[model samples]
Each structure stands twice: as structure tokens, then as C-alpha cells.
Target: MLVAIGACYLDTILTTPYYPGEDEKLRATNVTRRRGGNCPNTLEVLQQLTSHESTDEELPLALITILPAKSSITSQQIRSAFRSRVNLDHCIYRDGFEEPASCYIIKSKSTGSRTIVNYNDLPEMSLEEFTGIANELGPKATWVHFEGRTPEMTLQFVRYLRKQFPSIQVSVEIEKPGRPGLQELAEEADVVFYAKTWAQNLGYRTAEECLREQSTRTHEASLLCCTWGQDGACALERGTEDFKHVAAYTTENFQVVDPIGAGDTFIAGMLYALNCKRKDWDLSKRLAFANRVAGMKVSQEGFKGLDRALLSFG
Candidate 1:
């Protein structure tokens, strides 16, 4: 099974024709509430792509997320957000926490941009608690992707997973640039995923510029990938001096229905193409597939039918 480790939150999203200016009150055209967060958004896409496959033949997708205490309404909503195809057998229930972490998003329809404000009150998962679940999932895990949060402990998790489950392809999402120790985790991971905003924050103007420079800092990253909004994505394989670039998937309609989970969808698509059931594709196909998956996500309201993006490959 493929496991994703991170925090999942209850999301409140609002849509408006345009982002309002400072101190200006704006009315929303619509509001949507659901379960979201890096890991959950990713699993929403992966579960669909791998859904209905016999577990005996395919590696199932599993989540290792922390949630509110069992009795909370937020916890119940989270539990009900996904289908039976996703394995929540290894989730962590944070006791004494009644409210789930929440995110409020304001999206601009005209520009397809979103402003996000996250509110997380629960405590971070302790190493002991993390290991308890990782140990059980280790033997069955073919690949594990970690959301880059709680940098210090996350770095430790990478080390422990490496020592305990060396055969697994460990991937780390380095979306938050200010998170200290993320570089260390990136150095240890077999795959490192970079975010465009994170790269821009570091003064790099292009995705290739960021990956090519950061490639030297990673000691063991066999694959380094980064997605830039319209420019698409670029990746580098270990021992290669040149980077491969793929253009963004363009839909004829040119519509961006939602951008809230586009990045998560990109990561999910990449994981599916690189290590899931149809993993044997060459690097070019893998990159293109992920691009199309994300393209499809932005063209829709949510993750429903996001897996159809893969149908083109067949």
C-alpha cells in the first residue's frame, strides 16, 4: 500500500468574482465546506485512480493523518469525506482535541487565484505515536509521501522510516519553504517534490532554476520535481545534468473551476504515475500524466472524476 502522512483539516471555501481590496467587504457567490489538507486532498485523487482494484494485485492507498477526538462532529465529517476505497486503519485520533484543524479560503474567479488562512489548534503528533502507526504500515508500504510540516519531527520520521523501511520509496513534499529542517528531509528522501511558490520565495524565477540548484543539496534524491503554474513542470533524475520540462495541460474551455487542491492533485498524480499500478511509464509520460491530472482537477469543482484524467493514457 501507499501511505500518506500529514494533518487533515475541515475546509471552508468561498468563491467571489474577484479578490477584494484591503479593508473592502466583498460578498461571495458561493461557499463550500469539506475535508481538506495536503494528505487528504491527495488521497482523494489517488483512491479514485486505484479504486476497485483487488488488493491482492494492486497496492492500496492508505492515510496516516491526525484528526479531532472521535466524538467531535469535525472528526465525523472527515471520516465520511472519503469512500471505502481509502484505508484509514492507521489514523491518529488526537485526544483532548475537539475541533479539527480548519482552513478558510477566498478564491478569485477572474484570476483563478486563492487566498488561504489556516487555523490549526491541535498538537503535533509525537514521535512515539507516529512510529506506532509507521511500524504497522512499514511492511506493506511500497511508497510513503510526507507533508512537510513540523520540520524537526518530520526530519526524524524520514530517518526512522529510512532505517526501518529502507526498501520503501520515501517522498517528501517541500511546499513550505520557511519550515526549518525541510532541507534535511529532502536530502534523505528518495523523491523530493518542490512547490512553485516555495521556489519563488527563495528568489528563483523559474522551476528549472530552482531544481537544478537544489539538486546539489540533496544527497539521495533520485528524482526532483517542481511545478510552475502555467509553465508546467520540470524534473531532474539523479546523475543527470539536464532537466526535463513539460508544458502545462491546456483545456479547450480554459476554465479553472477551483485551485484549492490543485497542488495536492499534482502530487497525487505524480505518486500514482511514478510508483502506483501504472508506474512503468518513462519519465516523460509520468510527468505528462501528472500535468493532465492537475489540469483536470482545476477544470472541475472537486476531486470527483479526477481519475478520469488517467483514462487518456490507456
Candidate 2:
């Protein structure tokens, strides 16, 4: 089983031919809404990839996220996005208090860049809530990924999970480095995925430098992975002095629709391949598969063909 912990969002995705400047109003080329957020995107991809598996057909997925305050419309939309296999019974629903909804304005024609405006008014999950659930389901999951947010609470969760469920492999996405608990979370996580921009924010010149720096400082992280948009990704495992770089998968033959969730998809693909536990596949092979998965994601809108692409991989 795999569990993903973090925030959930009702994303309003807008597409326009070109990005508008100040005070400019233009009709949208397309508009679609869906359940988004780092955790949800990864969970959704994992759900799809595992759906076709014959050996692990019964494998379970649990999404630990915060629910909006009794908003039926938003709540239902979020639920509808999750697969039937995902366990949502453990989520925390903030009662009476409404969190600001997340919205994304994407310019498809102008190189598929997106402007995200989000408000996280909802409270982060308390340690007590997480402990209660972990106590009940400690041995069920073999792997867990966290969307690094609410640094204190997230650190607590990771600490507890490590202390109690020592056998479980933990991976954390350090997407927001400015969060209060990131340093601790990174130090404790078995695998840390650092965003390229976040690495630059921390004064590292390149992903290799960031990984190398983090490798020297942390004892728990066996693998540190970083993604560089068109340049692809690179990773450095513990005890290694050199970085392994993999070029980005090409999408020249296909139309690039949306690249909003490509990173999450890459993480999901890598996690899925990791959980498969094939001894013959090394780090570069695994990264190649993840790159292909991300390429498939960017070629379409909203996770289309993700499952098929994953299964089709050699």
C-alpha cells in the first residue's frame, strides 16, 4: 500500500491563446475544473497505474488530505476525482471554516505557462489527528509520500512514522522550501525530491550541487532527486560523489497541452516503479521511466493516457 499526505484543491484551470497584460480582458479558449494539489495529483496517477496490475490488484492507496468546510459542491468534486481504490475515510474535514480555493490561469498558446493563485487559509493537519490514523494503519502501507507543507506538522508526522514504522519507506516532495518544517522533513526523509526553483532559492547553483550539499548534511536521505524542466532530471544517492543526469523525454511529435501537473506525474511514476521492487532496474533506468511518464503527461491535458503509458513502458 501507498499513502500520500497533504492538501487538496478544487482547481479552476483556464486556458487562453495568449497571456494577457495588465487590465486586459479576453475570452478564454477553454476552461476546466478538477481536483488538484501535489498529493492528489500523485495519488490519482498512482491509482490509475495500479488499476491495471494483475499481481497487485488488491494493493491499497490512502489519501490523507484536508477537506473543505462542508462545501458539498467542492467536496463532491474532490471525491469524484479520486479513484475507487483510494481510501478517503481518514481525511480531516475542516468544519465551519472555509479555506480559500486554488485557482490556476494557464496560457496554452504562449508556451503553456501557468499562473497559480492559491490561499491556504485552512489549518494544517494536527499531529494528534495523524497519530490516531497512523496508530491504526501503521503496518498497512509500505511506502508514503508527503507534499512538504505545514512544516511543523509534517515533520512530526515523518518523525512518528519513522520511529514507529521503521520498515516503511518515506519520500517527501520539498516543493516549498520556505515552509517552516522543510529542513527537518528533508533530513528525516528516506528520499527527498527537491524542486529546481526551490534549490536555486536555497543558493545552490545546480541540482547536482543541491543534491551533493544535502547528501553531506543528511543521514537519512538515501536518494536526492531534482527536476530541471526541459533539461530533464538528475539524482544523487547517498555515498555517491557523482550525479546521474537523464535528459528530458521528447514531445516533438505530440501537441503539448498542459504541463501543470508534470512534476507530480513524474514523482508518481518514479514511486510506482520503485514500489515494483525490481532489482535489475538501476537508478537511471527508473529515472528514464519517470521521464517517459512525465512526457506522456505534458503531451495531454490532465493525466490522460498516464496509466496506459506506464503499463506500456519496457
Candidate 3:
């Protein structure tokens, strides 16, 4: 079982032909509502890529997210949104919080960028609560992924998890730049994922440059990956400073239909590549495979058919 820790958000997405100017009135072409968040989106994509796509019994993909009260309609919607592949049996539901955290997204057709505004009144998960969930997972879990948020609490949980479950491999995503203590968290994770936003925020102009220069900041044995949209991704094996880069996959007449969750999709694909059944691939090949998966994601509307990302590789 691979356990993921993060929030469960109700995402309201609006697609417009172009980014709206300040005070401009432009009606959106489409409006969609769905269950979203880093953990859910990644696990959902991973579930789709597996051979047993309909059940978690063969390959358990579980989420440890905080949701609204179990009785709320929003919570029910979030729970029922995913297919049977993702196990939600270990969710934490707050009694007093009836409304789920919301993410309002504006996707522009012309720019291929998603502008997001988030509103969350729900209380953050405490370290104690996460420990309880970890205890429940016990010896069943093989890998645990953490979304970088509530950095202080997450940091504590990561350390605690390492001490408690020394056999379980840990992976952490460093997506947001403003969050403190992520640097420390990065040092502890076996694999660390860095978004372009996170990289660029630190004055990095390219993914390769980021890995080459920032390699010393993390632990010696940690593997670091930095994903730069369109240009593809670069990774570094920290111990040996073994760096590799893979270009973005694209076909003739390629088009980007939707960019939402592309990073999360990349994370899922990378996780699938490194931790899934196919483990003999080299660093470059793994990045290439993940690049294809993520590239395929942006070429379509949503996560459907991402399993086909393995077609050329297979």
C-alpha cells in the first residue's frame, strides 16, 4: 500500500478563451466541479495507470486526507467522486466542519496557464492525527508520499514516520515556495519532487541548473527532481551527483487542451516509474517515461487514458 497525506478540496474550474483583464466581463465557456488536491489527483492518476485499475486490493493506493463532516453533502460528493481504485477508508472527518475546502481555478485557453484562488476554513491536520493514521497503516504500507503543506507539522510527521517505519520509503513534494521548513523536509525524504514554480521562485532559470546548483542543499543520498513545464524535467542522484535530463514529449500538431493537475500528473507518473512494476529503467528513461505521461496529460482534458502513456515505452 502507498499512503498519501494531504487535503481534499472541492475544485471549481472555469475555462475561458483568454485570461480576463482587470474589471473585464467575460463569461466562461465551461464550468466544472470535481474532487481535487495534490494527493487525490496524484493517487487517482496512479490508480488509472495500474493494471488493476478498479480495485485497491492488488495495489493499494490510499489517501489520508481531512474532509468535511461525514454527513455533509460536500463530503459525500468528494468521497464518491473517485473510483474504487483509491481507498478512502482511512479519511479523517471533522464533525464541526461541514463545508469542504474550495479551490477556484481559472484556466485560460490562450495562455495554457491555470490561475487558482483557494479558500479553506477547515482546520489543519495535527501531527497526532497523522500519527494515528500511520499507526493504522502499520506494516502494510510500503511507500508514503507527503504533499508539502503545513510545513512545520509535516516536518514533524516525516521525522516521526522515519523513526517508526524505517522500512517504508518516503517521498515528498516541494511545490510551494513560500512554505518554510520544506528545505528540512527535503533533506529527510528518499525522493524529493520540485515544481517549476518552486524552482523559479528561487532564481533558477532552468531545471538542470536548479539540480546542479541546489544539489548540495539536500541530503547526500536523496534523489531530486525538478519539473519545468513544456521543457520537460531534470533529475539528480544526490550521492553521485549523477544528473540526467529528459525533453518534453510532443507529436506533430500537438496541442495543450488543459494544464490543470499536470504537475500532479507528473508526480504520479514519476512515482509510477520509480516505484511501480517497471524498476529497471535508468534515470533518463524514467524521466522520459514520466515526461510522456505528463505530456499526454496536458494534451487532453483530464486524467482519463493516462495508462496509455506506457504504450510507447512498453
Clashing pairs in 2: 151-181
Candidate 2 error regions (>4 Å):
56-58, 69-71, 98-100, 240-242
Cα lDDT computed for each candidate against the true fold: 0.85, 0.81, 0.85
CA lDDT of 240 in candidate 2? Answer: 68
TM-score of 2: 0.92
- Give the per-residue lDDT digits (tens) of candidate 1, residues 93-159: 8878998889999999899899999999888888998888888776888888999998789888888
**Model 1 stretches with alpha carbons more than 4 Å out:** 52-57, 240-242, 277-279
- Steric clashes per prediction: 0, 1, 0
List where candidate 3 sits over 4 angstroms from the true fold. Answer: 52-58
Per-residue alpha-carbon lDDT of candidate 2 for residues 1-314, written as tens digits (9 for 90 to 100): 88999888878888988888889998898899887898889888888877776774445789988887656567767777776889998888888765535766565577678878786677778889899988888799888899988777788898898899999999999877456668778899888888987888889887778888889777888788888788788888786654688887775577677888888998987887777634556888878887888888888888856888755667
Which ten contiguous residues of candidate 1 have the minimum total lDDT?
50-59
Candidate 2 vs candidate 3: which has greater TM-score?
3
TM-score of 1: 0.95
The order of the candidates by lDDT, greatest first, is 1, 3, 2
Cα RMSD for candidate 3? 2.0
